[model samples]
Structure formats: C-alpha cells, structure tokens
Target: MRNKIKKWMRKVCFPISVTVCLLMIGMTVKAQESTSVKKGIFAGDIDLSGMSEAEARQAVTDYVEGLKETEITLLASGDTEVAVTAGDLGITWANPELVSEALEVGTRGNVIERYKVLKDLEHDNLVYPIQISFNLQMISDILLEKCVQYDVQAVDATLTRENGEFQVVEGKTGYTLDVETSIDKVNKFLTEEWDHTACTIALDVDVTEPRGKAEELAQVKDVLGTFTTSYASSGSNRSQNVSNGANLINGTLLYPGDEFSAYESVAPFTKANGYYMAGSYMNGKVVDSLGGGICQVSTTLYNAVLLAELEVTERFNHSMIVTYVDPSADAAIAEGSKDFKFVNNLEYPVYIEGSTSNKHITFTIYGKETRASDREVRYESKVLEVNQPPADIIYPDPGQPIGYIVYDSAHVGYKAQLWKVVLEGGKEVSRTQVNSSSYKMVPRSATVGTATADPAAYEEIMAAIGTGSVDHVKNVIAILTAQAQAPVESPEIGDE
Candidate 1:
C-alpha cells in the first residue's frame, strides 16, 4: 500500500513541477517581449502590433501631426466665416505614457493570465485610444486674433429727412464670438466627441439686436417744440458755419434715455468739417475762430429742447452775452471744455429737424405728445442785476496808417435768470427756474494806428494815445491829413 501511494504522489508531483516550469518560462518570454507593444494593439486607428515603444510613439506623433492641418471654420453673422487649423490651437499628444501603457498590455500578468490577454486580442483589438492635448489659451488667442474680424457690430436705427418728410432707416443685428466657452467646446470635441477626422464645429456666438425699430420710430411724428434764431447780422463765413452746423444736427433720432451732444454732432472745427473763421467772444472781446457761430445752432436747439420738456444733462452759459438769444437762454459748446447735452426723457423717440433758410436757423423737436392740449408753457428771461461798463479801452495797431481807427461797442453786464412758466387751461400752475447766467461788462474797445512815414506824425499819434482820448487822436489825424494834402510851392516848376 505505501509503495502504491508513493507512485501516485510521484505522478502528480512530476506533472505539477513540469507545468510550473513551463509557466515560469512563458512569463520570462513575455517579459523579454515587453520592450514592444503586444500584438493586435492599436493607438486609435494606427496599428501598434509588434512595434517598439519608440516606434509606437513616433507613429502616434505622426498621426497627431497629420491632423494638425484639419480645417476648423468659425462663423458669424452677415455670412462672415474664418478658417483655421488644429495647429493654430497648439495641438499635441496629451499622454505619452499611454504608449508605455500599451506596451505592458500582455506582459503584466502571470503566464496564464498573459496568455488569456493575448488570446483575447486575437479576436478583439486591444486599443489604447490616442489622447490629445490643446493649449486653451492658444485656442482663445487664435479666436481673438483670427476669428474676431468676423464679428459684426450692431447698428442703431435712425431717421432721415427728404422733401420735408421724415424717413425711417432700419437697424442691423450683430454677432460676436464667445471665446472661453468656445475653447471648452473645441477641447471637448477633440478629446471625446470628435472621431479624429476632418470635421466642422460651429463656435459659440452671441447675438445682439439693434435698437429703435421702425414701429418705435413711427411715433415721432408730432412736433413737440420749435425754435428759430436770426443770423442776418453775421458775415458770409459766419452764416455758412451756422448753416453747416444745423445741417449736421438735422434728422437726428434720439430714443428714450438717449442723450444728444451738440459738440460731438458737429465737431473737429476744421475746414474739412465745413467750418470757417468767424467772430466769437473770447476774453471779453470778439475774436475770429473756426466754428465760431455754431453756438447759435446749439442755442436754438436748447430752446427747442426746453420747450419739448426734455431732460438737460449738461449745459454751459456763454462766456459773454450773445445777441441771438436772451441772457440765461443760450447754450454754448467749446472744444475740450464746454458742451450742450440733453436727454430724451419721454417714453417715445424724438426726432430733431434742423434747417437754415433766409438767414435764420430753426430747430424742431418732434415726438409723441403726452401732455394735454390745454396746457401751455412759456420761458421768460428775468434781469436780476445790472452792471455798467467802465471807460473805453484802446489798443495800438502798428499795421495801419495813423488815421486808421476801428471801434467795438460796449456791452453791459447782467446777472439774469430764465424762468419756465406752465399754465393749465389759461391759469398759471407752475413757475420754475430753468437757468441762471452772469455776463461780463465789456468796455468799448478801439484799435488805433500809429504807423506813419513821418516820424513827427507818428510821435503826435503816440501822444494822442497817451491822453486816452479818441477825440485827441482824431484831431492829430486831421492835422496830419491836412498837411499831407497841402500843395507844394509851384515857382520852381514854373521856372523849369
């Protein structure tokens, strides 16, 4: 019985030992083959079977490089499209370790387990999907640089006047790229959603709707207020400036809560902008400057705006008194300093119509009238303080002859206020102060000449200027004129 048991043990133990030895040898072979990826393995569609780690890496890199030129189109409104490439977004292989991961596929487990894995690969591929990386900031930068050009800017609806009729101009919609969100979308598509082939992706875009539709602007038909100012006394150049400024401001449409800038509407003050040198008040004196008479246009618009009951956002009084409008009623705009701005506070849009005819500039504010027909409004100029001008001012002009003289009349200074009176059904209901102003007292100024060929006559004119009297200067000028006109002795000529 002992011998028979020994024989059975030997038979079992020998087979077990042989099997263990064969398993150890098989594992050793798999370890040796670990330098290369297992058979039937793939990185995406590129076959990596029996390929070394370096070769597999190179293959994957080549695949990524080949995909670098894939076309990606960015689209925007107005049929705007921009084409870009994957390389522009800084694409690269994300996981290089996956190549090594692929190499260890059948070599990692015990001999039987490794055999089972290799057997499984015979029927089903052992695919280590190719993962990629993208520079997110690079993607954003590309969209900003290349794709931003396709963005459309929203345009506001406006109005135009033709043949004394108001015409409506339509607005356009705008589209802009959403860069950050678009980057995320592109990254996700490339990493998980994309099939790694030539494909198109629509980027994230934002839509903007324009303001002031035609239906909204059609309500601006009733005339809310109107004002006119005369420029008959202005010279040809000054009158042209007035007309030019009025034309620039004509047919302007202002929606509710919109502010109008008088200076910005007609600016640059250059000859290119249709302005000419004309007289304007400066340093208590009249000086010639470009766009000099444009203040009259703003003043006219201001009165009309006041009558329309619009909100005044910014306003400035002129440095000196102006003859076109009463004190405390004028609006002035200067370069870099003063501006006249008003807001359309009503519920509907307002259309400004400006025109110049027969030496008069007129501004009319048209909008939907909400006030009762029985309501009446009027503006009154009130004088608070009167200041008399000082003695006449004299300036010497070296460019003119001794008898040449020019004078400017004095202007009296005043502290004045404008009042807005509202009446309902022929009864006064409200009286409010609209604005207040202070005018400087400018003395009568004279430019007198002292230039002469005769030193004696020049000295005489200087002496008259020292006396500070125009009569003295006139007397000296008369004497010089009489002397110059006196006939020379004729006896020499007769003898000849």
Candidate 2:
C-alpha cells in the first residue's frame, strides 16, 4: 500500500507542485513590472511605457497647447470666409489626468488579475479615448456676436404713428442662425479623437419670427416688510456709500423664487462709481478701503427680508461688532468672499424699495400679502458665553517722548444666538432660532514712547508709569513745554 501511494504522488502531485512554483515566479516578475507602464501602452501618438509621470504630463500638455493654434474657418453666406481661432472657440484640454492613467498602466486590480492584464499587454496595444472640452457658454457667446452682425431677424409688415409721425414698413422672412446648433457642432468637433489642426465648419441657415415691441412694466402692490437703520455717525464717505448702495437696490423686482444677492448688485465700488476711501477693519486693524460702510444697507435689507418671512439663503456676521445693529441682527458683506442672499417666499412677485435720507437707510419689501397685515416680526439676541481676549499687545513709538502711553480701542468677544419672534396682536405665536453668532475680540493695543527726551519730562512720565497711571504722561509734556518757553537769564548768553 505504501509503494502504491508513492507512485500516485510521483505521477500527479510532483507535476502540480512544479506548475505552481513556475506560476509564482511569473507573478513576481509581473508585480515588479507594475512600477513602470507595460510595453504596449500608448497615449494617443506618444508611447508612455518608458516615460516618467512628469514627462507624460508635459507631453500631454504640449499636445493640448499645440491644438490652440488650429485654424477653424467659419463659412458664411455659403461662400464668404470668417476664420475662428482655437482659443476663440474656447478649445482647451479637459481631462489632464490622462497622464496618470498611462503611468498606472498595469497597476490596477488584485494580484492575479493585475498579472493577467500585464501579460496581455505584451501583444495588445490599449488606447483610451482622447478627451478635449470647450466652454459651451463661451462658444455660444462668440457665435452670438457674429450672428447678430452678419444676419438679421425676420420682421412682419407694420404701420405705426408716434408723436404725429406716421410710417409704413415692408417685412420679409430673414435668414438667422442660432448659437445652440453652433455650440453642438463645435463640441462634437472638439471631441474628435485625432487632432485636426485645420478644420472647416459652416453655420446652418434657420428662419424665425421676431417680436415687435418692449413689454410693459409689472407693478408691485402691498408692503410686506420694512426696516430702517441710522448711520448718522458714519462720516461723509461712509454715509454716501450707504446711500449709493441703497439706490442701487431700489425698484428691483424679484419673482416668487428669485434670490437677491447684495454683493452682486452693488459691486465695482470704485471711485468712478462714487465710492470713497473710508476706514474698515482689515487684518485686525482699521484701514481705509472702498465701500466700507455699504454693509449697513445690506444689514438693513436683511432684517427687512427676515420680517417679510423670506427664506434666508446666506448671511454672515462682521468680524467685530458694529454700532448700527445689535449683536446677531447685523448682516455683513464682503465682495466675492462674503454675501447676503435671500429668496422671495411669497406666492406673488416682490419689489424692493430702498432709499437713504438724513443719515438713515431704509428697505421696504412689497409683495402679495400671505401673512396677516398686523403680524409683528422681530429678532431678540441671546448671549451664550463671554470670551476674554488675549493679553494686550504693546508697540514702541520713537516719535513720542519716553514713558508716553497711547491706548487703542479694546474689543470684547461674545457668543450669541438670534431668535426670530412672530407675534399676532401683541401676543407671541411662534419663536424660531435664526442663527448663532460669534464675535471675535481684537486685543487692545498700547503704544509706549521710547524716544530720549528732556530729563524733567522723562522723570515725571516715568513716575506716572510706576504709579500705574500712564494718562499723566501728556500732562508732563505740557509742563515741560511751559518750562522750555520760560524767560532765560542774560548770563546764559554771556556763557555761550
């Protein structure tokens, strides 16, 4: 029985073990090969198997850059010529990560599967789809400019008299081409696998009827909510900013679902737009900047929208508290980074009437009344926690006499919650939380004089500091000035 078993093992198990050993060795070689791309891998016309990742990326970028010079001719009037540059068509590389794919040629999947893929690459050349994308909107805009100039819209015959002037005009169907079809054709051409440096394409001729006159203005009725804020303390430039921003938002109509963006409406705050240099907080210090005080207009508008029950989409608090509005009630706006937005929630369209007069900014929201006319809406701020600012920072001033001290403003930090309250006939109905606000405190600053000065003034100033009251430093300066201006003895002239 032992001899029979040994014979069976020699015949079957020996061959199976040898086959398994050779397979393991093959897999080991294939795993090392994964560090580099397989032999038959290529990205477009360029072989990427031996090239490094960075080299492959540069090659792909150069290929796309080469496409930028491709001349695309637009055929017009069936024969006339208009040449379009690749850039004008917004042709640019879309999938830049294709280079990474080439470097990872045989590295994907499990061990055995990866080995199978690497083995297959020895004979088979795998090609991926080359992707080129263009900005559809940019293409549309470019085509629109050309179409408006080269083609005319269809017009129907009409007779009209305006201010005792009568006119009769003949109408004819006009040949027009739309940007939609042009955009589609351009996209298809851009996605073509091979780079055709020079291509010819033509816009199709389509017919359309045109409208005659402008639409009438839609009037808004009913006052939804109104709010007014006083900015009397703000100086001329800042005050003007508030008024300018308010005027920009005036008479603006928003449909039921329209979102109002305060920043978008009142941007480009250049001196040309009547914005003036005013002090604003930047990097923890007050610095002069344009459109410094227009945030007051946005804050007032925000409160008005909230009162009108509009859906608040976005709102932000200032880094520090402002005196115009209470904590958690103010809405702050900075161009591009921060914005205040709200959506009209009423069934009918809403109109904004904003105006500023006598240092006061007001926003009145008018819409179809869904809530009761007597409904009272207001916000109450709830303080959560008080935070202590960091230790005071000291700055040395050589221009001031030694021991002179000047104090900068101190900031207090707090966390507060804003609640929106709804009342009916002076009775509370519903109270909902609007937002939680956190005010960051900027540490108080002191500028200490370090310059050498008269001995009398210096001694008195030092005494004031040692006693814990630097406020007397200025008084010492006053006394020292009086002594210097006193009458001098005649003997001093003889000694000199």
Q: Kindly list the per-residue Cα lDDT of model 1 for residues 1-496, writing each as its tens digit.
A: 9999999999999999999987777865556565878778889899998898889999999999988998776664444677778888888998889898898887767677777787788899977788888889988888788777788888888888788677888998888888888889888887788776666777888888999878888887899999999999989999999999999998888888999999999998999999999988888878899988999999999999999999999999887788989899999999999999999899999999999999999999999999999999999999999889887777899999888988777889989999999999999999999998998888887889878899988888888888877667778889988998899976545554
Question: lDDT (0-100) at residue 95 of candidate 2?
Answer: 79
TM-score of each: 0.90, 0.56
Kindly report which residue stretches of model 2 are placed more than 4 angstroms away from their true locations once superposed. Answer: 1-145, 149-177, 180-219, 387-393, 399-407, 453-456, 459-496
In candidate 2 the C-alpha lDDT for residue 347 amounts to 67
Q: Give the range where candidate 1 is weakest over 10 consecutive residues by summed lDDT.
A: 72-81
What TM value does model 2 have? Answer: 0.56
Best by lDDT: 1
Residue 333 local lDDT, model 2: 88
Where does candidate 2 clash, by residue pair? Answer: none
